[model samples]
Target chain A: MTIRYPNGKLYTPHTSVQKTEKKSKSKDLSFSNRGKTLEDEINEANDYYIKRRLAIIHKKPVPVQIVKVEYPSRSAAVIREAYFRTPSTTDYNGVWNGHYIDFDAKETASKTSFPLKNIHEHQMTHMQQVTEQNGVAFIIVRFSAFERYFIVPYEVLQKAWQAMENGNRKSIPFSTIEEEAYEIPTSYYPRIDYLPIIQQLIVEKCCGFESEEK
Target chain B: MTIRYPNGKLYTPHTSVQKTEKKSKSKDLSFSNRGKTLEDEINEANDYYIKRRLAIIHKKPVPVQIVKVEYPSRSAAVIREAYFRTPSTTDYNGVWNGHYIDFDAKETASKTSFPLKNIHEHQMTHMQQVTEQNGVAFIIVRFSAFERYFIVPYEVLQKAWQAMENGNRKSIPFSTIEEEAYEIPTSYYPRIDYLPIIQQLIVEKCCGFESEEK
Candidate 1:
């Protein structure tokens, strides 16, 4: 079955994976059976965090430019014509323990690498600005084939992005991702539980432990 | 001329003020002749901040629920039918020096009081949650009659909202606002320079000087 987003974009789930496959190298692939989009899981996790007072994060509403509308009554208004606008920033951002958190989530069907094309230039600039302001900035990437999730820090993404801009590799290899990114262990209640990684990042940023570790 | 918002709400600018009025008690009223909406000024201010590396703030896109859409071409998607969704959070939020800043901008024609009807319940709740998480939350209110702007902290808004909930007062009096809120002076480049007040807030939050001053 094919799904269509609100903006009329086609969403074909697991088009690269064979339906008859019964075995996988990683145990995480077993959880892929749920067939939920990475966005869905992240939103669920955010809700869980909000409920527990652990964090306050939210996915921004998709940007749309409304050109025409009809008001049937004082209380009801219907948009008759509209177009999706290219977002100026990332998909998700909010406050987490007085620390500004900003990130974008993306999923790749590729099993070996995550393409740089998945991110936009404006998003990179926005993340850069966020980091410069001492905000926690990162990207949550999901490798759909293996049902693996990783929290890629903004610095790592910037390095890879700069390399790509310099006519280097167009994508970051899975091996490099595993080495530089922190893997998010999947669970039930909060499907993606990525805040602990953010906490670690805050600690590292505050103590300058990242350079020391390097 | 009548202006309708994207959601089809009528925005009658300065409806209560007479066009022939040449005198006002406050000097700020003179700037109102520029005829820009509060939202516009705020956006302009944000752009100025972003350009100068002062702060990063953005107004969230209007929430729209797309019911039907048509793909005219692979590159163009047209939304044919949609409805506005009540936003679950404030209109503006972003990072300013590692502190999460969240706020809603509102304009009122009344010179006496700011009606509680201008705000939504969910927005109040969202601001409460943001404040509870140690984020800086506030509201920017513009009194069109006087062309006066005030930055009312979340605590002040909460108090007013709670009073309304208890059936005490349905609105916050202008006097109360003048007493509790910080007035934003109009400017040329940024138009509405409100960040200086935010800096003061951060100082108070960090050093508890607010209580000391009180």
Candidate 2:
């Protein structure tokens, strides 16, 4: 079967399957039936947040090093030759209510627990440094199978990391996380509605339990 | 006169002057006195700072939306076609003493001042949002010709934006910026030691001058 590009006419049998598959994909898309990828949903949610002037969170731009440029005319400069560079932080970062907020979102199919291995060493180090500098660092983990979400604090992840290093399980037990971190209630209003957890974190910080997990 | 692809080889009856130019360029290509390009120098500085655990700054990845992929083998995926995406933030971001630092480095040939047109409206807005969220937002303005530098605070630039709104000057005057912003001295070690300015900002913020920056 020959596949055709979306820009091209999909007259081939292979292209029809993908079109048919995308049509039925709406029902199986997300926890709330949002027909979009996780990145798309988050970007939309971020836009929603930004429009209301609620918070100024944004996904950063990718870095590029232009090796060669083509000046087709004075009107345009095209980077004909360019290279990619490694990213240092989570996919998203910004500020909320006079607090620096940094987070990474990950989705896992496992129903039981999210894998600790999904977090990278460099990212882990980054979170640690953020917390040290007084920024709020978190991981928004979606257990896609269960449609459950949890805002895992950097410290909680660090503790679990230590445990993992000591020959403990490679995943955080659901019970420990439930007892410590805030379980974000998924809703249609804000979709993620993570700001409430940030509010709680702020309150706790003001109360002098700044470093406490919960 | 003509210049072609692969390596831009200039063949011209323009002059033997072109010959001297190529020879001088090849001679200067050796790492004796003059070093790497601006991007390379910044990368080196980033590495220098990161090794000391001083900062987590990194250039963002090049944005490429892959359209067509060729899988010669199941294990190997090659992106055959892609389109670049516009960058949202400056090149570098990281955790600096708990402040989420976001900034872009830019240079121009103009001897008087850098052009405001070099920055996009979206980028300016993004930086403002970062400031409202309490992150340190600024730009590294390099007058590369003179080898002079200044860290232009987001607020200062924002004011310039507002001024332009009222039919005032479109660009911030070089004299005004040189007087207002902290002038960074070029050095032999670590190259761009922007940490000094950051330290000053930290000290000021720590000294109960937080609300005033707004």
Give all TM-scores, in the order shown: 0.84, 0.76
Q: Residue B83: error of model 2 in Å?
A: 2.2
Interface RMSD of 1: 0.7
Candidate 2, which CAPRI tier?
Answer: acceptable
Cα lDDT listed for each candidate: 0.83, 0.67
Write model 1 residue lDDT over B83-176, tens digit each, in one string. 9998999999999999999999987777789998989999888999999899999999988777678999999989999988898999999999
Q: Which 10-residue window of candidate 1 chain B scores lowest in summed lDDT?
A: B18-27
TM-score of predicted model 2? 0.76
Docking class of 1: medium
DockQ numbers for every candidate? 0.70, 0.26
Quality of model 2 by C-alpha lDDT: 0.67
